[model samples]
Structures are given as C-alpha cells and as structure tokens.
Target: MGSDGSSSGVVREPLDYVGVTNRTSSGFSLIWDSPEEKYKNFVVTSKDVGKDEALKPKSTNKDSEDDSEKEFDNKEEEAKYEQTNKSESENPRSKDENRVPESVSTPDPQNKSGTGSKPVTGSITSFKKVLPGSSRFFQFEDLPPQTEYTVTLLGKGPGLLSRLHKLVISTGPEPPKDLVFSEVTENSLTVSWTKPKSPISGFKVTYTSIKDGEPVSVSIDRGDSTLGLSQLSPGSSYEVSVVSILGLDESDPITDFFMTLPDPPTDLRAVNVTDTKALLLWRPALAAVDKYAIVYGSGTDSELRVTVSANAAEQQLSGLQGSTTYTVTISSQLGSNESSEASTSFTTTSGSGGDGDGFGDLQSKDVTPRTARLSWKPPTKPAGSYRLTYQTEGQEVKEVVVDGSVTELNLSRLHPSSRYTVQLQAESGGRNTAPLSTHFTTDCSQELLNGILKSGEVDIFPQGRSGPPVMVYCDMETDGGGWTVFQRRKDGSVDFFRGWKEYIKGFGSLSGEFWLGLDNLYNLTSMTKMTLRVDLRDQDEATFAKYSTFELVKRNYKLIVGGYSGTA
Candidate 1:
C-alpha cells in the first residue's frame, strides 16, 4: 500500500497471520491480517533461495531471534499456535499447503525505524509498505519459475521494536523453448528443443497424427532434449507438444507441426518403343505429389531428363536410339522434397527408313584370318542399294556398295586377330538410312587349323608378318600336316603361261589351279625354312615330288630346293 517507511513516533505490531492466496509459474500472491496494535506501515521483502538453503534450520543469530519473536503475532496465529503447540512449530513451513506467496517490495532508505541495519547481499530484495487503510493483499510478478524464494514481513514504526516473519515457496516450471524438427524421413523424424532455465524433474512429449487425430505421449528425462520418433506413415502431418515437469506441476505446452517425406513412384516400365521414341509407365505413388522426374541414359552417354505433372501416369521419351539399351529412373516430388527413385530399362525398335532404318540386326559369320562374311535382315522398306563401311582401330575406313537384293557380302583382305567395326546403311532415292553397326575380330590361321581339325582355303600370318594376313590353300591331310601350297595344277581350266608382273603379283585363287604371287612366296620362304610338294595327277594314278628345306630369293626368280625323297 505504501512505498516508504513510516515516521519515527508511531507504534507498530507484527501482522497476525500471513498466507499464500494464489501462485503461478512466474509469480505468487500473499494476504495478511492487519495487526491489532497501532502501526504506521508494514514492510514486505523477498529474495530467491536454493532448495538446500530454504530447508536449513533457522539461524539463532540476533536478526533471526528477533524474527522468531514476531512470527504470526496476531489472533489467527494465536489460535493455530495454541492448537499445535509442538516444538517443531518453531521451524519455517516447508510443505506446499503452508508455502509462502511472493510480493513486490519497495526500499525505504529514509526510514529511521528501530532495527539493525546490516545489508542483505547477492539476493533479490524488495520492500512494500502498507498504510493503515490500504488493502492487505500483495502480488509479486516477473519471478523465475521452479525456484524457491524467501519472503519476510516486518512491522516498522518510530518507537516499536521491528519484528520479522519469514516463509519459503517455489514457482511452477517453465516450458521448453525453440522446438525444432530434424533428420526427417519417410517414416521417422527427430525433434529437439532448448531447455528452460529452471529446475525440472523431466519432460512430457505428445504427438498426434493429423490424418487420424490419434495422440501418442512419452516421458523424457530432464537431461535429454532430443527425441526420435518412428513407425509413422509417410507423407503425413503431425502435431507435437513439449511440456516441462517439476514435481506435481507442469508448464504450458509448446507445440509445432511437421511432415514426413513423400513416397516414390513404383513399378516403372517402358512400352511402345520405336527407333526414335519410347513410352514410360508406372504406378502412382501412394502419397500426393507435385510432379515426377524421369532420367534416362545409354552406355557411357550423358544422361537426359524430363518432368511430368503428378497426375500423369505415363511419359513419352523422344529422340532415342534404335537397337540400343537404355536405363531410366523415375521419382515423385512434393514441394521441395523428392522421393527415392524407381528405375527400369528398355531398347528401341529398328526404324523404317532414313537415319535409323535397316541393318538393325547386322552380324558377322565365318570369320577367318583375312576374310569374314557380313549379313543382315533386309530393310523394312525396299532400297536402291546398301553401302557398307568398316575400320579397325587407328585405320582409315573402307567402304563397299552392294545391290538392294543382296543381304550378305563376303569381306576379304582383313588382318588376323584384329578388331573391326562395320556400319551398314540402306540408300533409297538419294537418301540414306541411319547406319547400323557391329563389331568382329578376325581369327588367326593357326587358331583355325588347330580348332577346325580339317582345313581347305584359309588365311595365314607368316612369321614376322604385320600388314595383313595371307590367303592360302592349306593341305592338312597330306603325308605330314600344315602345308602351304604356292602352286597347284589339278585341272587345265586355268592357263599356265603368264607375264612376269602376273607372277610377281598373285594371280590365283586358293580353290583352283593357280599360282601364288612370287612376292608372297618369297616373303613366306624367306621368313622361315619351308618344304614344297608337287603332285602329278592322272585319271586313276598319282605321282608326287617332294623337296625339303626350300627357299625363294626376293626380287628375282631364283629358287633353292634340297632333300628330295618322293618318287616322281
């Protein structure tokens, strides 16, 4: 009621009884009966205290002795004191029923009342002086929660001795702050918060799914500020609340909302594939989505991407390659969140004409050291002709043209054990189809001889040969094995006489009576020791001439032969 203490000569008497009227997390209120004896004013003061200090026995020092004498000095105190006249009543009340209420106190530095003047330090102290006619109720506000406070009442006047009454009480706990959600996934999320600056026994966490409005609650230790929740539905919204607890009291709830990640599209597949386009289909995601992202790529190529609205169940991809395998992935998106991807693969059908037609199933067969047979299915539409081009690693491309009716062609003069890429295109009315490609490696003659068992016309690589393999007639069933025939004359269908140039350069076929080139013979014989055999064949009888250790000099027609043993 009053801020300053009363003037000197007024008589003062202690209040009769002081009791708590109301209390909250932040503050409390107190009420006291007016004293019977005359008094100018009553001073109320309070300071925060630790639990241990609040429970300690009251000190018997001079100030405390005086406080005891004035404790509950009025009529209500007299009745309660007489009822329970036990020695333990001398102690301050510690239970909740008798806990002290808080009050704002104003300092009265000018008061010259009769009392000791020792200063109170390191504590929150205030004085509220009530006049004779003012209300006896007082409230203290803006106090820390879950904290103990010591409050004292003193009747002060000029000639009257000052009396002190003390009480201890605690405020309710404060709520936690700064609630946050982290590490959120499709079915789980982590919640954390800042602890309130007050003593608390623990925390109570409650969450309810917005979809079903079913609430779940859990108790958490005071030391932990984070909790992980799982076993929830994907793409769901949840309301979460946190409350701090102290003994039987709890703070107001702090609440927020959170969401789980959306589900991804499922059962992705490709259909209606064409040489230049493909259609992608999938089952819709269970959760609502904003869009869908599709990504695709072929072997070692940069990936391509496209997007479709969430309502769409299929997406068409264009500008794809024919007869090529590709991998594709699809994912659902909601707001800024994207779900995990669902993936599939497919190959486009061959084109009908221009750029991606014909030759989709190009293949190679009968591959030898120096020759291979190339074949393919005819184009969907007829064409004037087909052009074929081929090349080995680090070599110039070679090309050949064939009639539209030809579906297969024989390739010749290829190197042994070499990799080659062949591309074929169908041409019609000056326009050409997309080139279809295939790869093959030529076999060495030695491999064919060893793997085939029987040999006729074959290709061979002489010792130290590099440019290309040689075409030859191998006599595998002779007296011994593995013979290269440079000359054979079993029929008169071929001419024997020929110019020097004709002899120098090969003018023969391995399957007929012909002569192998002198240049080739010289190269083969010069590389290593060789043996030659000449067979004379008539109607039913045949005679043979044989020579071991034979050689042919280069650039000249010189011949060397020795060790003949066959009858001629």
Candidate 2:
C-alpha cells in the first residue's frame, strides 16, 4: 500500500515481515517464515495476554483519543440504559443549598460487570451502592425533565451504620412510571400507563394464586391479543399485577386487583295440562327471571309464542285440536341471565254432545233376591270407554271400566233386602261424560210353609158348659161304630122327637181306646191334654154325658149319648 499524506506525518515505519506458507479461508496465514529457520513454524492460535507488559497502557495516549473513546462509551450506554423510575417533588433544591452537586446524580446499575460500563443516569439525592454482597432499601428523587439540576450521592450502610462515600451522579433521562392492571380475567387483562418520556416496550403481568405460591409472568403483546389464562377455576379470586419492561431498563410493578365468575342456576321445572286450552305452569327460577314460551304441536304442525309474562303463574292457550299433544318451554332471554329451559307435554281434551243417553239418568230395575239389573241408553256419539259405578249407604264405590258401549249391566252380590244406586259415565276422546244415579231394591217374601198333624197326636176338646153340653169323644167298639157324638134336650115330650131330632138320653161312656176323625181333615197334634163330653137332645129335652178319657186318632169313631130317648 502507498501513502498519499504530506510531509513528516506520512513515513509510518514498516515492520520486518515474512511471507506465509499456509493460507486459511479467512485469508489469514497459520504459518510464517522465521528469520533464523530453514523450516517453517506455526503461529499460536490461542494466546494469553498475561498481567505483565501486556496490560501496559499505550504510551501514545491522546486527549482527542480519550475524548473519542469516552464519547463512544456514552453512546453505547445511552442505547443500553433506560429510565425505570422517575422521582418527583414539587420544589427542587437550589444549587447553593446543595452540599455536593456532582456526587449523587446517577442510579447504580442493578446488574454490573466488567464486560461493560453503563451508568444509571438520573440524579440521586441519596445513593447506596447495595454493596457487592449486600442489599438494602433506598429512596431518592429527581428534578423535572429539561431542568438544569445537580445531584449529590452519599452512601449510607445498612441500618445507617457505615460512613457516606464519594460517589458520582450523571443524568440522561428519567425512567418510566409504574404500569396499571385493570379488568383482569381468568385468561387476560388490560394494562395502561404513562412513560417518563423515555423509550419502552409494552407492559406485562405477573400473577400467582394462593394455590400457585410462585408467581408466573406474561408479556402482554400489543393490540388486544388474548393471553391464555386457560386452565383456571371459576369462582376463584386471583392476585395480579402489571409491569412495564423497558428496552433494557428495569421493570416497574403496579398494584394488584381481583376478579371472579358467576354461578349456575338450579331447580328448573314445568307442568302441562289440557282443557279447551292447553296451558303450562312452572316453578320460578331462583338465579334469574324467567319468561314462559309455549311450543305446541303433534309431530309436524307446531306453534310458538312468548306472550307469557314473568309474574304470571298460569296461562291459558286456546284453539287446540282435539287429542293433540303439545310441548311447552320456559326460558331466559339474556345469555348471562339465562337458565336451562324446562319442558312438558299435554293432550287436549275432546268435546261431548250435551245429550249422551248412556251417561244420563241411570236406572236400576228387575230386582231379585240377590241381584239387580241396571239399564241405560247408548250415547249419541261413540265412546272409547265407559265407567259404571255404584255404592251402598256410606260405602265405597264399586266401579268398572269397559271398552265398548254396555247399556244393561248386571249387579250381583247384593243383600236380599237392600237398595243400591248405580251411576254411569262415558269417556270419549279423552273426555268424560257426566254421571247419572238411580236406586232399586231386592225382594224377600218366599219364607212361609204348611204343617201336618199325625197319629199319637191329641186334640183339645170344646167346653161343654153350654145349656146342653155336647160330647167330644165316644166309644167306637161296637160293630158299626166309628167316632160318634150325642146332643141333649131339656124338655121331655114324646112329640119332641117327631122330625129330624135325636132322642137318646142315656149311653155309657166308652173307655176302650178309639179313633176320632173328620172328613177333609188330618190329625191334630197340638192338644197336650184332652176331655170328653156327650150331648143328647130331643125336641124339648137334652142330656149330657162325659167321658173319663179323650181319644185323638185318625180313624172313624162312635160316641155314646145320655140313657133317655125322648122321641121313642
């Protein structure tokens, strides 16, 4: 290379040189010729510059060079150091009032090493280099930006035990103010702040729960990006704070806030019914106000309406088709204010003609000793089923439901002499007809029979105390004898017996056993004791005879009369 500069400044000495024998890709030679060698020698790649002459200061140090180096160092420091804290007081100390102006102006770099020289620039009112091995809390203030101010540094040991040190302070810009965290949620949050007119990136949030004793930090990316706060439990309160991470500066911490989630609703219910109208009723919700919306249909035809109010306990919806089922729902309008809808179903009732004979005027007839026949007329319309019920006095009803129309019913198991009421109701198309009642009684009159008298039976005799006593029994031992009796007469006249008169006055009483009977008559057996009497009568006279024993047997018998015959 040739020199183009002027006079004496141009002759820079050229050192004795040797040519390289081996070359590298970087255009550097690993081997150089040695002046005393006939062979080549290799240059050491790893060299140690020991603490001897190697560290000696360059003898040609220049004020301009030192100025340039210092300037370059200042620029590098400017790029690396950022303001993290800005201390402010309304009134600043006057220069004359300051004990030392230059010593307390810069903050110590929290992390310092020999690799670089970065001065924390802002005047410190009181500075303590947390000794290389020790840490202690410190406080200070800085003047407002653009203000010409001087600061002094005085180091105090822990617990104010050590003397003040002569430390220097420098100034560049104040650090950014603390960041604020608000509207924190399980997964994300909003951060806000004002920087100290210094450079900085966006803010970050560091959080931990009581469960996670250790804190976890998140860098809040700009532009509403969602930070994953996933896997968090609902209804839990979390401690969270935000901090601003300046380019290469310290982080600033803010105060913490908490948040929680809402709970779910419980005990939902619904009930459905069918009248001419189909209505739905339900128990109210505790977590939210609910409105009822009915959805009614069979399979394909359906209708929905939200006409029901929150305060209304019951609602009637009309114009329903017969035998049709409808589904109903009660729900909430707002999502956060919502609950699960309750569901129910019902079938509409059918209509009946006012004059269904099968259900009108039930009548019980054809009564017997143990049963009664109940009869009714058929209904005008067809029925799905029929229910006939009856009851005794103060007794439960006996009921039967049949599939078809049954007009006449037989009710057995009735008491012999009892009355019963029968009621009939008809069910058609899910509707029940009105009931009718009638009463009937069973009969009891076939309980009387005839009795007969036999032999060994005795008969009671009639009293013979009349004017001419008659005999009830007589001796029948004679050849032509059967049961015979005698009449008596008081007058003694020959002509008294002239016509149709018996005149015998005396006849001995027969003592032998005899039979007494009459035509169209059977034996009489109720007579416990008996007596015999005889009566003999003529036209004017009559006599009486008495027997010692009375006979009562079923045979022809003869009787004796008194010993006189008036007619002869």
Candidate 3:
C-alpha cells in the first residue's frame, strides 16, 4: 500500500524466502503491536551503498515543510499510486545489486540443489550441523602433527535445516607430517610431529602391542603438541595411530610402530647333573631381540638353538638328555646395540659298580707244627711237588726241603709250635715256584732222646733205659749209616754209644758234605770245595754244567784221613 491509500505500480512482491529484500525503502521500522506500541527503527545511509559513512549514524527524514514540499509530496504520492495500479512496483535497486560485477569473477551462487546460495558465501544462517552438541570449534591453535582423527558438528534443530557450520576444516594441521616415536625410555615413549597448518581442537593417539586390533587411547590437551606415553611395558613393541581434530573436522590417520628398550637376561642358574646331563636355564626375550639361541653340552659339543621372542629361551632343548652335559647361550638382538650370552654345565652320578683285580690270594687253612706235616696242593696251576718253602712271618725265607711224593710232608725239628707259611711250587726246570700259599701254627715238643755218632768205635752204650728222656741223633748217613743211642742228662751224664755198624761200609772213605740238593732229595753230598756250576735257562729249564773238586773228612780205622773227589 502506498501512503496515498492506492496500489503502487511498484508491486510489493514477496522476497525470495532465502534472501532479505525490501521494495518499500532503504530503511525501515519495526512496530511492536504490544499494549505500549513502540517502534524500533533502522536506517541505511549512503555507506550501505558502498560509501564509508559509517562514522555518522543516519536517521530517517520526517518534516512538515513549506508549500513546495507539500506539492512535491502530493505529486510523489500520485506517482506511487500510478505505479501500483500498473502492477510494476518491483524493487529497482535489487536488480542492480544482483548483476555480476565486471571486474570480479565468481562461481554461481546456486548449489547442487540449485539453491539460492553456496555454503561458501552463505550468511550466518547457512551453518549446517552433522551431530547434535558433539562438535567444537578451534580458534587460533594449529592442528596436531602426524595425527589422524574424525570430528562432527551438531545442529540446533532436527530436519533439513543447515544448522552446522561444519567447515570440515582440513584445517587440521597437515596430518602431522613425520609422525614419529623417539626418546624411548624404559617406561615411556615420546611422540613428536611437525607443526600443523590450521587450527586444531584436540589430538588423540591409539597405541597397543597387538596389531590389527583396537588400540588404547592417549588424549592430548588443547595446548599440547607432544605426547609422552607412560607405563609402557619394558622391552615391548607398540603400534600407534594418531587422530587430529580441527573444529568439526578430522585428518587422515597416520600409523607408526616402535619398540621399547630391551632388558637383560634373567633366571640364570645351574640345573640337574649326571655323569653326562646338560645344564639348562632360561629367560624371556626383549623387544629389541631378533632371535634367541642356546649353546649347551658337556664342556664339549656345544649346540646352538635359534628361537624368536615368542619362543624365547624356554626349558626345552634338543640333543640334551636329562642329567646330561649342557651349555646355555642366551643371545639378544644385533644393531648399534650389543648382544650377550652365558654358559653352564653339570654331570650325573653313576651306578655303584666297577671292574679290576681287587684282592690277593688268601690261605684258608692252618698248618701243623712240631713236625711240619703239611698237606698242601697247588691252589691254582700246573701241578708238581710242593717245595714247601717257608719263612717265619716277619723273617727272611728259611728254605726247607721236605722229601715226599705226597701232598702232606713232615718237616721234623721245626721250632716247636712256631708259625710257618709254605708256598707250594709246581717248579719246573729252572723257574721259581709262584705258588699259592697256606699258613699254619706248629706244636713243637722236646725229643725223647739225643744221640751223636762220631767216627769211632763205641766203647760203651746205654741199654735198657726205661724212662722219659730227650735224645739227639747225628749221623753222616752218606759215608756210614750208624745208630748211637744215649740218655739226655742235665748233669753232663755219662752215656754209652752203641753202634749199629751195619750201615758202615767198612774200610772206606767218604767225601763232601752231606746236604740236600736243589732237587730237594737228601742224595748229593755237596763238596764245599767244588764248583757245582748250573746254567739257568728260561724260567722253565736249567742245566748242570760242571762239577768241580770236593773233599770230605773221613775215619779209617784208628786214623783220620782226607778223602778227595776229583772234579769232572
């Protein structure tokens, strides 16, 4: 409606609902229809037309003036009514503003839907939302570096209302260039990245020991650019991904993996031992290790077993028997880092048994005494007569020749009841008798009588002496076999010598001393002056080579003469 109460040919058409336009005037007034009606007015100065007049606030003009003003207003009112009647009251300034400027080029404001304007140039009302109350905006801060994440903005109301200004601002720092893990310590790791180009709201890092799985999150405060991951397992590896947030936008995720420092070998010890069991022990491998191997055996034969971290130095082994020799070698990874190894071994106890000549021969029987009547046979050997060589226990061997073919031989005149050991010999030609031996105690008793037979006729002899008495018998049986009996007297008794004369080869002389030969027979009367040369061959054989001169004292009637035996 015009001021004159007529339709203006400048038709008051409705503005495009998406844009604000007014055909009435450059300035307008909003009237409140409340009980206290009031008006809030706004004015558009020449500054609204691209002139800088903002310094002065302009107001609408309203005045009752002179006759010229009244006439001008009347005519202006007529013109307005004529335009309304013609239905041509369009906003003239709107067309000029819509025309593209010749100096500046721009894309069509129409959107994919051919909407009124593109979000890029859209007014404050064009803000759109993706999620409700789930978004935040970043002002001046740069996006986190080497990080990945997602962001969402929320709209105030439901429906197709473009309520979110979600500028999916790639504004997120360029997914932190060169996201890296460094300065790793025993229990912590430092992650750093390049500076971002745009502002960021927050940052998050996902990390875990496992691969291809959901990781744990470490959030960064608004102003922090670096992350220090703590409480990390020592000697462990972790895969990390970063998520950066900028306003309501997120950057592409970046992933990286790193391992913690390695630990030293543990659980070192010596295990079981036998005569040959290998020793063993083990420890878990650290993250810095490439593999593991063990060298174990008797101090010899060292074996190397290759193993990975998962199968680290376990208690299993090859070529290692229970209670056998072993050497352990635990090795770590190689690089700027140095590796290490250790070794040990032990032996098992053996069963109780052994082999050898453990004992000497032992005599099981006691020998007879007084008369060394010993019955001994070779305990083990080629049999022959026993020489019955004996010596007192702590005395030099006193060789005695006992004559007899029987295993039992009587040795008369042995010290009464003295102990003696007889070594039986199966002596052949010249060999010594290595005889098994026997020992015995002796029972020696005084002889009943003693007698001596000299080279002379007996003048008197004791006869019919019936009493307990001791006697001595001496005879040169080789020359003359004679018997003389006498009663032993404690007081130099006078006794008679009665000769049996039958053994005396009358009128003959004899030579040499009557002694036992090496044959052990009381046969050969060895001449003291003669050389009885005997040649000893191998232990088994011997030969008598020479028999030299010899002499013997003999009695011939009333004269004592020397008997000579020529050497042959």
Task: Rate residue 261 of model 1 by lDDT.
Answer: 85
Write candidate 3's Cα lDDT for 1-568 as tens digits: 3312323222221111111111010111111111111111111101111122322222223462211111112334234334422342245344432333232223333333222121121111112111112111111122223222121121121111111111111122345557877777645879977645656677777887652243578778557767888866445568887766654445566788886665444433333322223234444443335555555554554455554553444454434433233445565553333244543333222212211011112222222223544454322333334465676545578665543344555556554334455554444344533333444443111111111234322221111112112222323241233322111222323222324342231111112212111211101111111122323344675442443322121222111123333332
lDDT for residue 520 in candidate 3, whole number 0-100: 13
Q: Model 2, which residues run further than 4 Å from truth?
A: 1-138, 141-197, 210-214, 222-231, 247-249, 266-568
Specify the poorest-scoring 10-residue window by lDDT in model 2: 445-454
lDDT of 3 at 555: 22
Point to the candidate with the largest lDDT. Answer: 1
Rank the candidate models, highest lDDT first. 1, 2, 3
Q: How many backbone clashes does candidate 3 have?
A: 54
Clashes of each: 7, 44, 54
TM, every model: 0.41, 0.25, 0.26
Candidate 1 local distance difference test against the native: 0.66
Q: Report how far residue 472 has shifted in candidate 1, in Å.
A: 76
